[model samples]
Target chain A: MPEERRLRIPGLKDRIPAACDFVMHAARSAGLDERAVHHCQLAVDEAVTNIIEHGYRGDGLNQSIEIICRAERDRFVIVVVDDGPPFDPLWQSDPDPLASMEDREPGGWGIYFIKKVMDEVVYTDEAGRNSLMMVKHVQDAPRLENLRDHVALKVSVSNPVDDIWLFAPHGRLDARLCPGLDRLMTDKLEAGKCLLVLDLGDVEYVSSMGLKTMVSLWQRARECQGNLVLAAVQTRVHEVLQIIGLDLVFQIFPTPNEAAAALDNPPA
Target chain B: MLDINVSAREQVTLIEVRGRVDSANADQLGEALTREIESGHTQIVLDLAGVEYMSSAGLREIVSALKRAKRGPEAGDVRIAQPSYRVREVLEMAGLDTVLQIFPTQMEAVGSY
Candidate 1:
């Protein structure tokens, strides 16, 4: 495989959607799963938005944001380069997310979300330009199981149950955490268990890239004679879902457990 | 670049956020707002209408100004006017619209201040 694709767009908000589409297409052509493709898309958005807003100061006429997507054996690397003033996005240390919204400041959450979503984040400010590199591992291959401690937000599979959980993750489902969700959903769907429940209790936002992943996963689940269900969706996520009209396609629930139970005995 | 224009009605600070607002320039806008606040200006308006986009860094500047106005000794008030649609979307997404008062017209914002 050539293993890489590159694009350069003028620093403008209008170009952001095209830039994201280019990355999504590249990832799909590289044989990456839909979720992984979505992760790359959001990562590209966050990076390019930074470049357009901060790098060129929204001067679409002046500067440009460059994106490069490279596929590795196990991971995909997306590099965003800009020729704006020297600024390193990786060095930004986020203040405590747990702080109260009032006491807490408003900015810096974009980079924080980017760091949290990607597995590995690297930044460089060489030659008075900024380069942010994000990496996400591919989850198509069957892998060994490691007995890791279960974290609250970490996605994992329980026993071989028939229910499908379609977690319509809102917010920035960026490069950091998409792989985990992809792995969990794919593993369960591949096992032919159809009972699904998506916990969206915490998802308040989702990028277009994230939406694409959810659609692909829904298709995969349908192919297996199973269906995916969403639960406890916040208004913000629900709005986007409704905008795309996926809300009508997927079975929605009020809670994760409810969706899981309904999957066990779907209404005729 | 920091560009400040004052009138008898209000002090309008137009901080052109050129680059990403990460930690680097996060304080640049905040400092500009604070300087205006300290100079005995109670009624202030920020014209982010020129700002093509904003991130958490740029958002922090707005929040900082809001807090300063709220805590000022003389009941200082700050209003944001003419934020771009993208900026407005982000603010609504983050629920900052509920926290910060937004105005569509600079005249409305200035009048409020």
Candidate 2:
């Protein structure tokens, strides 16, 4: 099924939220998951904010944004079209997080987060406007038995018992829910088990509160002589880690299973 | 667009901003502040209670005003009061909250100065 929606709101910052709300409702009605809907909203926010801030330059020329949603059997596709400059947001260099706050830069994180959240992100300049297409897979609904009964985070521990693996998260870790994950990790660390594998497969977005939770967990694990390892990180999160040079600080694996296996056998 | 209402009491200049602060009308805010500052009013309190949303570009205007005030001969300070949560988040994200003195109430903001 294909449905198209368009909004022309003068390219002003105030209208961004309304635009985001419209996209979210459309995406949800298209049968996307809540997490996926949030991702789409964030992507739209970042892209449209860029257009309003950088593209229109406050010209008040009634800058326009168009959202197109197409639902397939297993995936939903959402496209954002803006009559902005010929800039490809995907090509922008990820900011260096290691740089001091004074030297650190603003922006660039939004696009990066969009890439991380959506399953696929593509950018193109068509007919003098920028188009960003984001795809999200609609997984079969979780089985009743597998559904989380409570609000607790369901952490999958992959590593063996002897070696230690750590999960280190960086970026905007909001205070509301991250502490729950941190507490779960700390509980495992206190058990004196060394091998730990962190499943960062689902974490692409975070805030300052989330960052603190990660650091706190890392310190707790270190105190127990257990090592921290990160796996399945999105490019933007990885860039932040690398900029801070934390890529050197934490052992990384491409997947949680790989991290778990590495914990099982020490490289000698 | 931003609607501004100015109220002058003693030496304090209170500017109330209504509606959204985006790229569309951020310049108007800067102009208003510049006109006030040019009119020899140094102590300024901006009431953002009416502002529902603000973006980074809108935030730049406020920052610009702060910079202009700092550089002005009068050495005036621009303070924001009663900012909405969304506006407050943008300010915090941009790290402007630390650079500008923000108060929760207009009376407190004006009384402090």
Candidate 3:
């Protein structure tokens, strides 16, 4: 059975947070991971902010906006309705993401982000109400197929200790690089070196594919009576782990040395 | 909720922002950046290590600040450091990552200016 939730707020600027929180809570309850929840929250925030600012024309004290979230088996949907004049945010053209600083303009980014993060977006006007619908899958469908075939993940392995090995991977750990990391880690686990530390000091990003790779490595290591730990996680990657609830599942350390020490000590 | 802290260095001014940056308090961020720019502190390094989430409204403020900082004769720049994953994703989606110089560390961002 699909679950549905609804929230209505005055078109005031202060109420945007409430609307966003309601959507986030609903997204989480629908079994969407933290990254998906964040994306939903962003879409809602953008839609509501646009309603209050552009739709209401800065006078939203009396207007009201309605937000509805529906969780299906495979996807989650957010619908926002505003009792304002006819304004379709998607009508605006997308701004160039690669434009130079001098050529950059900020006005069109809100709509651009909405389109980028959400799997689908639709806008409608009926009975004097404007509605914007955004949808995101629970397990986001893969967009880049065979990406690993072209790009290579630069990984360096260091046997810092007799029993522990540290693997440092550079660049983004997305679909293109996760396969390589997975293969490398799998090889190490098969070789009886199960106690592993992933040094993410140079890793700039981690996609859903990367998280899946890490989980797989962790599970494989545990099956062999060994463990995998993360080390030197950058601030952004750390936050991603926390958002996806992996912070609790993974033993994260500040440095490779500390991670090696933990591997030796082992929480008993 | 949002918390912004500003400290002026000899060559660059560092602004540390924490918490959620949304429509409700985006004006505060805009004002802070404006304050620095008005005071002739064009060389700015924004540290987003603590930012939990940021909306398009917050990104707008950043772009506005970047434009204002680079407008006049002094021609200062705004660089970013240590943006959280969510914030970085949004910035990248908005194409601000291409327009602005982003460093991995605060020291690097400040040093770039």
**Top-lDDT candidate index:** 3
lDDT of 1: 0.64
Chain B TM-scores per candidate, in order, are 0.79, 0.94, 0.97
Residues A1-268 of candidate 1: C-alpha lDDT, one tens digit per residue:
7478889888877677678788879878767765456546656777877777777886756777888988877777788888988776643555454454466665556665455445556564444667776766566312312101111122322322433444433334544456556665777678786556666776666677667767777788788887777778888889989998999888878877777777777779
Off by over 4 Å in 3: A141-268
Docking class of 2: incorrect
Runs in model 1 lying further than 4 Å from the true structure? A1-3, A6-67, A70-101, A106-108, A111-268, B1-24
Which candidate achieves the best TM-score against the true structure?
3
Cα RMSD to native, each candidate?
A: 15.3, 13.7, 19.6
Give candidate 2 misplaced runs (Cα > 4 Å): A1-4, A7-65, A69-78, A83-85, A90-122, A125-129, A133-268
Ranking by TM-score: 3, 2, 1
Superposed by TM-score, candidate 2 places the C-alpha of residue A215 at a distance from the truth, in angstroms, of 29
Give Cα distance to truth, residue A150, candidate 1, Å: 24
Question: What are the Cα lDDT values of the candidates?
Answer: 0.64, 0.65, 0.81
Judge candidate 1 at residue A64 and give its lDDT: 78
What does the lDDT read for residue B18 in candidate 3?
92
Clashes of 3: 0
* Model 2 lDDT per residue over A1-268, tens place: 3566655556666677787778778778878766557656766777777776677776635667777767766656677778877766654655432443344343345555455445555554455667777666566322112111212122223223434444433323456457545654676677776456665665666566765666666677678766666788888777877776777877889987677777666687
Chain A (alone) TM-scores for all candidate structures: 0.50, 0.48, 0.52
